[model samples]
Target: MNERQRARRPGGRSARVGAEVHQAVTDLISERGYGNFTVGEVAARAGVADSSIYRRWGSLANLLTDVALTRLNARSPMPDTGSLAGDLRTYAANVAREITGPDGLAVVRLAVALSSMGQQGVQARDDLLAERTRQLQSMLDRARERGEHAPDAFAVLDHIMAPMYIRVLLGIGPLTPEYVDGLVDRLL
Candidate 1:
């Protein structure tokens, strides 16, 4: 193959492997949870070698982290509505749908279970949470620029997101649109 062909080939192969591995990780976690699966299992399921997974992700924890991060990012896009309330409502509704969905719920459970394993696991959990917070902060900054109630980004994120996450995590209440609307109403 020519040089350009080689370069393009690697990109396609790398993307395919990454997608396969990610799907494998999620499927294994969904089937047996995080604590019970092995990297070998993931490799076999993904149709890639174990060494390839290790070379790409370094460890199972890292792989799981990548899976969670990728899935979350793909599912939860930052909202860009014209108003703060509109933005918050859209964001909250998206989050509610994700957390309540099967894939999202599975990832959340796997992430929580993986956190106690070691530093890698803990870092994965922290990283995912940080990314979520960062997205929220960005939305808040946009709202602030639009002359909305501009509280500290972190503080406002905590106030708005904490209860929604808590309700989902604890199974206390449903993350309904009405509930999210009320939260946005109270916040804005």
Candidate 2:
């Protein structure tokens, strides 16, 4: 296996290290821009030796990418609420909770900054988008099966999620249940 894959093998560093280090990285990135942070600083804050982090993530950029993406995926899977509007409201509420929380807000800020940097940041941005889209798609699939949704499933799903994220990225407002319900109504 390739080195990266080998390092991610079960019981390898990936399996042993819990979310603590990731949380620390998120905090540091939020307080100090990713461009200003160093792995040594992250290691010290996370209470791990620098070598420990280096062995797992290789570089600050890679570490940041993994930290942001991993945390987003760590949220609970979207709920199946039986109706498209109901399911999307639940999904939106869940996302709103996460994105407005301290860790989630920090991760979103870092992601927005990274995304604005163009090609250099495209892969990580794309990976985060794809992962979140997959989660939203699962909810959309359930809605479609229940006959609560119309055609253009992808657009419908995007219409609900994209605005929530845009607000988070722009610091326009907190994602509230009221907002989630509003978006669901418009999308449905």
For each of the candidates, the C-alpha root-mean-square deviation to the true structure, in angstroms, is 3.9, 3.6
lDDT per residue (tens digit) for residues 85-183 in model 2? 666676677778887766555565667666765664666667666776777677777766776654354675577667877788788886767777887
- Provide the lowest-lDDT 10-residue window in model 1: 2-11
- TM-scores vs. true structure, each candidate: 0.83, 0.72
TM-score of 2: 0.72
Local distance difference test, each candidate: 0.77, 0.70
The TM-score between candidate 1 and the true structure equals 0.83
Model 1 per-residue lDDT tens digits across residues 1-188: 65434423555787888888889887887688777888999999999999888777777887887887777777878889888778878877888788776654665576677777688788767776788778878888898888888556566567667777777778867777788888778777
The true-versus-predicted C-alpha distance at residue 178 of model 2, in Å, is 3.6
TM-score winner: 1
Which ranges of candidate 1 are over 4 A from the true structure?
A: 1-11
Which 10 residues in a row give candidate 2 its minimum summed lDDT?
Answer: 148-157
Q: Say which candidate scores most in lDDT.
A: 1
